[model samples]
Target: MKNDVKEFFDNSEHRPPKFGVLQGVKVVFSAIEVAGPLGPHFMAEWGADVIWLENVNGGDTNRNYRPSEHEHRNDRSMSLDIFSEDGMAVFKKLVKEADVFLVGGKGPSFIRKGITDEFLWAINPKLVITRISGYGQEDADPNYIDRPCYDGIAQAMSGYMSQNGTPESPMPAYPYVGDLFTAMFSLSSTLAALIRARETGKGESVDIAMTEVLMRLSTYNMVDYLNDGRMYPRPGAKDPIQGATGIYKTKNGFLFTNILGRKQMKTLFNMIGCEELYGVGDFKEGFSFINLNWDKADYVESKVEAYFKTKTNEEHIEIFDSMKVAAAPVLSFKDVVEHPQYKARDMWVDWDTMTTEEKYKGVNVVPRFKVNPTKIWRSMPHIGYDNDVILEDLGYSEEQINELYHKGVIFRNDRDK
Candidate 1:
């Protein structure tokens, strides 16, 4: 088992995979908030030179977030207080040399900061300027455009929250799914534009809206709503599948199951000794029967519940796995992080494994590649830690760097200087 697991990891491991898809590329991150930072985080993993062009006001503010110990690593930080002339000079220098510049904030306010798409384009015609916002790149009325929005706001506006929870009270989905999906879409779209820029010798400003991503993901629900006034809702919805689909409680823990195919339904019925339900097709007959008689739905649910209650979670898992039925335990974080299956699959890594002390936590990169995998090259920068390095790269002398530091145009960790 260990050898097989090792081979599986060796085939897909990120420890020195054939990365460098974005080699020789420079990305300047002029954005600070949550959604803005995410897409670029993945790009940095792809071997690009990502510089965090933070503001001296607070330096990206992500540092102040809870559990932000590892947030300050992996990238170089240079506090570009662009409000000042000297700072704007340094900011322009970075943008002039950058291939992709990520900018975020509200629509009008962010553009008014004097770093427009046109400005960056003229500086570096090949620069792909990417923008992310709650309402997109709007210059509309402040009432709508200037409103503060978060993950829940996107969920509510995009019709996701409406269908997520029970009918008693709709609950917001946790784990920041709304924010994350938006970032993912933005990443892929921006990569496409970056590709186009490389081919066309012209840059593009890609604008992404948070609510729009959620709206696109909620298309199926929109379909039924548009067809009729009724929406395909899941509030208090028991079965997601046609026949048997739900999280069932066993002797030990909860496990989710899906009876999708006719064979699976027949096998489940035989296993439960419910001969009457045998040979019921999942979509064709079982769905019709449940729809026709509410009592039948209740009856089937009760039988499934009873059958699950008779078995331990492990037993249920074993039986289902052996029969090729879909089943999985609803794992918590503690169960997941320590799981042998995930460890064997190389899903995550020990953060401080190579370090002297384990100060940082675990790290799991996103959108794993089969061939050209992404790699983590550096730690998150200390506040303005890359100030000297970036300044020197831009042809600034040590005296010039000291002048900017003394003027408070840049801030850094004391150890940085």
Candidate 2:
């Protein structure tokens, strides 16, 4: 984390001192929506020179979209309509010079634009091309292929959403869950491909499907079905596999805790002064206690909840820490930002924000390295905020850049608006 943090959001292009794992890598990010942008965003965090390519029309739709004021926006944007003549020239130049090109779109649309693996290989033989889509390019069924889908749709298709919530009314996870899974998956694979390409001098094109990646994430459920023909029911906050692992209500806030084995169960039974409950009614192993006596679940839950209610969140936390159990308060976004736990862990940092001009603060980068930890040096730029500098670096004359703008081929989203 070694950038001149103050100079970043301004008009400077000087990279930070710490070149993270992906140093010297140039990425051309041509993605329309969230899932597509995240790969490059993460690479940017890891010290990649990401030339974020937005659309000439309105840029990435996220610039025009926001769930709410407090929601964490991932700096959504796009640049240049590569279909335009002048824009295509610049795009081709970028491809010829770049190491990695990550393009996000539907299958048909990518083919329609003539943005194929072969085309990319022809431009830069050593470049790694990553293609992200809803279903993916290789889906044999045409009915599902090239179909437009997003986060919620992926969750629904992958059966991840079905495993959520209670039996009464199952619920979907927040929208970003599916997209995030796809992002990390795409980023890691792209990095692997990039490494191989650098060594072999031959590029690789990858196709990542949002639905497939998320389906793989629900491997826990898949194991039960594969091994024992048992499909887990919707769990909500409780373990769908039926373990003594859940969020319990405390006097102040909720406490999330887990008991791994019967030894811990014995400790819990003794702690609650219900030792007779241990190994009772052939409840000897695994989740047999709850599964065999489903009717008594409320009674047992009430007893546990009542015991927890005797203590506050802090007291429970101290006790749990002493007990060597995994537990924590179910914190909200605000609580996370202000919590001492996060502060001690160095998970938050102060920085300028892209959405607003005022000084803002939020999270630290993830996938931390002990030597060169990734740093959020600059806030993501406004639409074409670095057009002059970027074009200058690409050897484009000011006149040529102005001509491109005049021809409606490369205008910023906020031009004379």
TM-score of each: 0.85, 0.87
Stretches > 4 Å off in candidate 2: 1-9, 12-18, 65-78, 280-282, 285-302, 353-355, 413-417
Alpha carbon lDDT of each predicted model: 0.70, 0.71
* Alpha-carbon deviation at 283 in model 2, angstroms: 4.0
TM-score, predicted candidate 2 vs. hidden true structure: 0.87
**Model 2 lDDT tens row, 9-81:** 3323433334677767888877856788777887877777777777666666776554211122223233576
Error of 2 at 34 (Å): 1.7
**Global fold similarity of model 1 (TM-score):** 0.85
Candidate 1 ranges beyond 4 A from true positions: 1-19, 139-142, 236-243, 271-295, 351-358, 366-373, 415-417
What lDDT is obtained when candidate 2 is compared to the true structure? Answer: 0.71
